[model samples]
Target: MPELPEVEVIRRGLAPGLLGRRILRLVIGEKRLRRESSPEKFQEWLPGRVILDLERRGKYLLFRLEGGVTLLLHLGMTGRLLLGPGPSPPRPHVHLVLELEGGLDLAFQDVRRFGQALVFPPGAEPDPLAQVGREPFSREVTPEWLAQEARARSRTIKNFLMDGRVLAGIGNIYASEILFAARLHPGMPAGRLSPADWGRVLKETRRILNAAIAKGGTTVSDYLNSRGETGLFQLELSVYGREGEPCRRCGRAVARISQGGRSTFFCPRCQKKK
Candidate 1:
């Protein structure tokens, strides 16, 4: 699935073309995504509404439309939001296409069908947003806040970081990278981290996320920007997929371990368990 940075990249890429463009029509695919609004609902809320703004909350893309209707999208694993001049190519696995007024088509393509496309009417709150935690770049996300949330939680630091309800938009890829950058073991208990340790984690989280966004996000697999360009951040990865590779900091072998059923890559020498 696309994490925060990847989603943010897509939002930025699509904003310019989407804002002020009215949805001319909806081209619905035969197959359905994991979570999607009904065709009737989509048609009722989306067509003819001009896109006012594009925003990203956690990993979800929000298209604020005229009359306050919101179009929400979540690119699940193997999902790509592609923007192109119409007529769009006959691409396979495209679940939805938003035909715009200026001959542009915004298509939601998901090979695995795990993506989400929903439209909320005016005054209706999106249920998925209720689960997303604070943005990593928000000023309110201090080290003290992270520590307070982790209090009494015995989950591993890696698992804790991956929980969207606590800190939104982090997935396995960024979790491993953030833990490695913080020099904190993925296996350490969340509650065991001191405020200083939390500070390092928070700092590195913002740094890595901003860096990934600048590089257009890490495209280890299916992720791509709206322009269909692959991200460049994978070339700069330190530990996420470099198992048995030498650690850049300590010259020790970068290690891989499983936590909460996800692979974690870190330098054992640099990120010592406390």
Candidate 2:
């Protein structure tokens, strides 16, 4: 799945092509996308309207429409947004296509078919996008919020970070990276942290997330910018996916462990249990 940074990158990429354009046609090829939010309704609300702007909350993408409605898209996994000339022979899994007034069509393709395209009217919110806890990139998500959520939580730091209810948008890749940078073992309980530890974790989380956004997010698989280009952040990864490799900071072998059924990589010496 595309994380926050990757989703943000796609949002920025689509803004230039989408905003100010009128939709001439709307096509929804896939059915069974989040209940009651179908392609027919999407086309009905979208074809004649203009795209006001685009925004992202956590892993969800929102397109503010002319009718005060919002089009919410969750790129669950293997989903991609592509823009190009019309009728580019529908690639496999090209489930939804929006033909713009300029004869250009925006195609959303998903190989795994796990992604969903939903149409939400004004104040008619969807749960998956609404349940996220915070805007990790905004001032709203402060160190105080992080510290408060960490208090009395016995879950592993990695698991805690992945919980969107506690912290928004820090996914598997960033969780490992943040834990490595904070020098906290991924398996450590969140409540064990002192004020100083919370400070380190919060600071490093922001630092790492910002750096990843700057580098255009990690390209572990199938994630692409608007123009279908792979991201470059994978090359900058220090711990995640480098298991058994030499740690950049400690030279000890990076270890991989399963946390909540997800693979987490960390430097043993640098992020050892405290």
lDDT for every model?
A: 0.91, 0.81
* lDDT by residue for model 2 (1-274), tens: 7887788878877898999888788777744543337655776677788888988888888888887888788887888899888865667777788898787788888877788788877777666765887877677766677777878576888898999877777889989988999999999988777788888888898888787777777788678777777745564888888989999997999999999999999987898798
TM-score of each: 0.98, 0.94
For every candidate, C-alpha RMSD to the true structure in Å: 1.0, 1.7
lDDT of 1 by residue, 30-132 (tens): 8999999999999899999999999999989999999999999999898898999998999999989999999999999999998999999999989999999
Model 2: residue 73 alpha-carbon error in angstroms: 0.4
* Candidate 1 local Cα displacement, residue 90, angstroms: 0.7
TM-score of 1: 0.98
Candidate 2 colliding pairs? none
